[model samples]
Target: MLPRRSRLTGASSSDRGLPNATVARLPLYLRALTQLRSQGSQTCSSDQLAESTGVSSANVRKDLSHLGSHGTRGVGYDVDHLRAEIAQAIGQTQDWNVVLVGAGNLGTALAAYPGFTSRGSRIVAVVDADPARVGEQVGDLSIESIDQLETIITERSVSIAIVATPGQAAQDVADQLVGAGVTSILNLAPVALRVPEGVDVRQVDVAAELQILAYHEQRKGHPREEAEVSR
Candidate 1:
């Protein structure tokens, strides 16, 4: 984590219990700032960030305010400083050890994706239930059997897991992940997971997201639907 500088303003947003909506947008802002930094940007006004990210300038300022940032009224914010603050608030300052479950195509792609480590997560381990897949290499890590899941997780101090298993196996995999002491899960399979309190589960239902897009597309073609709703 960046050393707490005296120049920084009030308490961080995480400390102040920022709203869920604001917390979600922090990453978007961070990504935009990171891209700007890569492009040789040293300072960024909230309006510039909002414009790049498609968010309103007011919301960009409001969300950043929660993090205790006091940007110069006219000079804008220091890009690197703001990026570090956002990353720190989001716990990306510390490297999070991650474990990937399943060795299927989706899992393979995720394991190979360079973004996770670049964004502060390290894929320490990968596990699969299929014996045939055991010992197979995914990226730099060799796939281990599900039988070793608990042991590997305990030894590596893994706090987060990505589940890319088939829907039928997702629940069982989740149960094992919880039992193995994983605190957070990013489940890609389309299944409702029942996790105990204190455990965070973020589910990504690809089909459901596609369905939502389909709804929007249908409404675009059926303008009468919007007219009826206004009645």
Candidate 2:
């Protein structure tokens, strides 16, 4: 286990000065490092890691530098050491309890996602109102009834909740989660949720990206013609 102080150190306000974009890319770097580690690579150069993660070598070096200089001048970074440092920096070294509400298809997929387990986040409970699906198995855990949410959350101390129901139920579920003491939420439904002060809510719309892509495609095919000259 990593020391509590070390876990808190990397997330200090000073470190948050790093650009949000860079912070978002940390997971990609960490995933690449995990893959390399699993393959028995003990050491790796920035170029090698860049090839695997598709990040530029310069960018990789710059991102790693933010967490402090962990690479050697001639030999590149030590894989295990870098992995531990990155994991700790991302708060993955400590366990985080999460709850998943609305066990529909997308919810099921999230419940079975292996990425969360590898990181420190664990889905300790799955909640759904459908009685038919309540006892169903998702990955290693059994789906739980929604009525048990408060008890389960209190028992697990769930700080995060993932809302995966339809847009109509999104806000209701979010309200319930907030009521049950969740401070952070990852909302998959299309609806925007209103939470109290200090609570965090992040929405992930699956079709929004498609709409952006379609908009770009239309612009490409119907390019604005240059201004014509008169005569």
Per-residue alpha-carbon lDDT of candidate 1 for residues 101-163, written as tens digits (9 for 90 to 100) = 988999999999999887889999999999999988889999999999999899998999999
Give me candidate 1's TM-score against the actual structure.
Answer: 0.90
TM-score of predicted structure 2: 0.82
TM-score for every candidate vs. truth? Answer: 0.90, 0.82
Q: Global lDDT of each model?
A: 0.88, 0.84
Per-residue error (Å), model 2, residue 138: 2.4
Enumerate residue pairs that collide in model 1. none
Best by lDDT: 1
lDDT of 2 by residue, 86-195 (tens): 78777788889999998999999999999898877999999998989988999988999999999999998899999999999888888888888999999999888999
Model 2 Cα shift for residue 12 (angstroms) = 10
Listed per model in order, the count of residue pairs whose N, CA or C atoms clash below 3 Å is 0, 0
